[model samples]
Target: MNREPLSTKEKLLDVAEELFASRGVEATLVGDIVQGAGQRNPSALRYHFGSRDGVLQAILEKHLTRIEERRAKLLASWPAPGPRTPRDAIELAVVPLAELLSTEAGRRYLRILGQTMYELAPDQMKGVGKYPSLSATIDLMRGCIDTLPPRVVDERIQGTLLLISAMLAIRARDMSSRRRPPLPLSTFQRNLIAMATSTLTAPHDEP
Candidate 1:
């Protein structure tokens, strides 16, 4: 069956995602995206998305909405009181995000997310009211690690997010480039979840 052609707006988004992922977002120019999308009009990006930031937001919303839905389902399917261990909560957090690796567009979004995540403030990373599923996952993970002081828990949570994004971004890049991923996909995912679980559950040392 023939695939449907992408609309002009989708074309722009596709090009923008690639450019933003390969080049740092700040380094990718608006004109580059416009030209890459084969849009003759210089204003096409502006017409579809108000500005560079708007384009970035659209890209994030497009991918994250799907991720949020998947996470919500996982959370709902849990047996009663929720995740029983640090690893269980970590699996909830990592699995939905890792599923993105199954598709090319999803992989590109992962790369883009990795680029942008470090720049976000702590509150922004939590996504707070905007992403209830993500917030709930964070809360669930926090409960599993409640032995730590509040500040330490927050730091580990942030670290876990950063680690997920960075590692998945590298995996995405490998898949995109056709490089041999050191481990098979199943092994990679299991190990990634294990590493993240360790980060969250590691014992805290006194300052």
Candidate 2:
């Protein structure tokens, strides 16, 4: 009964990602995704994804794959400020991720990711981990996180993750924010990397 599942799955994910990216995922429904993909099968969504969450997972895998490739390249080039220091490794890892937030696609993906991470209150970390690409990034970040101050590392790690998610979400929330010129993608990411690196690595004042 199933027909061309791969093509259907890909089409569904493509339409859904675009729809979710352009329109908040909450605003778009599974019926809407099926419609956008021009599929007539009433059970198209269920047959393909089994659930909306499944579709989301596929979309995330597509995006994360490209991002992981970039991260690997960057990590491979670890310059003088080598990863021996967690700060250096974290920055090396974060710069590429942050830079994407400044992009149109990145912003859209972030909005959806942010919602999963916070708004919808889903522990997408699990879904994300299902794919090795996303897990690799998290693993790298965790490696850096492991090197931080024990008393505060947990808090800082959680905060940094949240900050990145929030920043990406905020970018989408204000796609047309015109009060001030938006920071260029590279610059914003550079600053974000530094800020996050400093927040975790800087010696805190011990009163």
Candidate 3:
């Protein structure tokens, strides 16, 4: 069977995604990525992606573009003054990624995304600003949370995003491993929607 070869840029992205997911991004080196991609040139990473951060951002953009498209379509169908249910808003944000998890690459990418969400340094965080789609979805979630009082929305929004990232990462890892007491993807999505809904809508006391 003949398989078309990956381009130099894609080879790097593929190798980097796996390494970044299995080993933390900071722990993985440009040398490691190029070597894993079957390239001998240390300069290949720099030539293709400029630097480690550039590679990571490119990988993120690749996936976010697709995920954001899904979110946009979902948002379009959802009525304006949107997301009457907590589940509605949360699903708009995450269900696309869950659908992506049906593929091997999606699982790998999710692991890297989880690491980025939880582990990146403050300076590294700036790269996230490059993705408008991601920002739009986040703003949508904030608007969804507006059903709550302004005080609660202010207090809980950041934590809600963090929790969503962490939980989805955990689920992505679990999905990749094919663990015993197996969690079906549908079940995982259902539970996540429930948890996210509760977290966003949960009552808060003013300080």
Best by TM-score: 1
Q: How do the residues 1-207 of candidate 3 rate in per-residue lDDT, one tens digit apiece?
A: 998989999999999998888787899999999999999889999999999999998988888888878877876676666336556667776788778778878888887877776554433333445555566665566677676775556556555656777777777777677765256667877887788778877876556
* lDDT by residue for model 2 (1-207), tens: 878555877788878877887677778899999988889986798997888888897777677788777866776676664346555555655666666656667766776777665543223443555445456555555566575555455455556666666766676557634334378656766676776666655554555
Candidate 1 segments whose C-alpha is farther than 4 A from its true place: 1-5
Per-residue lDDT of 38 in model 2: 85
- Quote each prediction's TM-score: 0.92, 0.71, 0.83
Evaluate all candidate structures by whole-model CA lDDT and list the values in order.
Answer: 0.88, 0.67, 0.76
Residue 103 of model 3: what lDDT? 81
Top lDDT model: 1
Task: Give the alpha carbon lDDT tens digit for every residue of 1-207 in model 1.
Answer: 999999999999989998998886999999999999998999999999999899999999999899989999997887778338888878888899899999998999999988987876656655566888888878878888888888788888888888988999999999988999999999999999999999888888888
Prediction 1 TM-score vs. true: 0.92
Clashes of each: 0, 0, 0
> How many angstroms is residue 30 displaced in model 3 relative to the true structure, after the best TM-score fit?
1.1
After superposing candidate 3, which stretches have Cα over 4 Å from the reference? 79-83, 119-136, 147-155
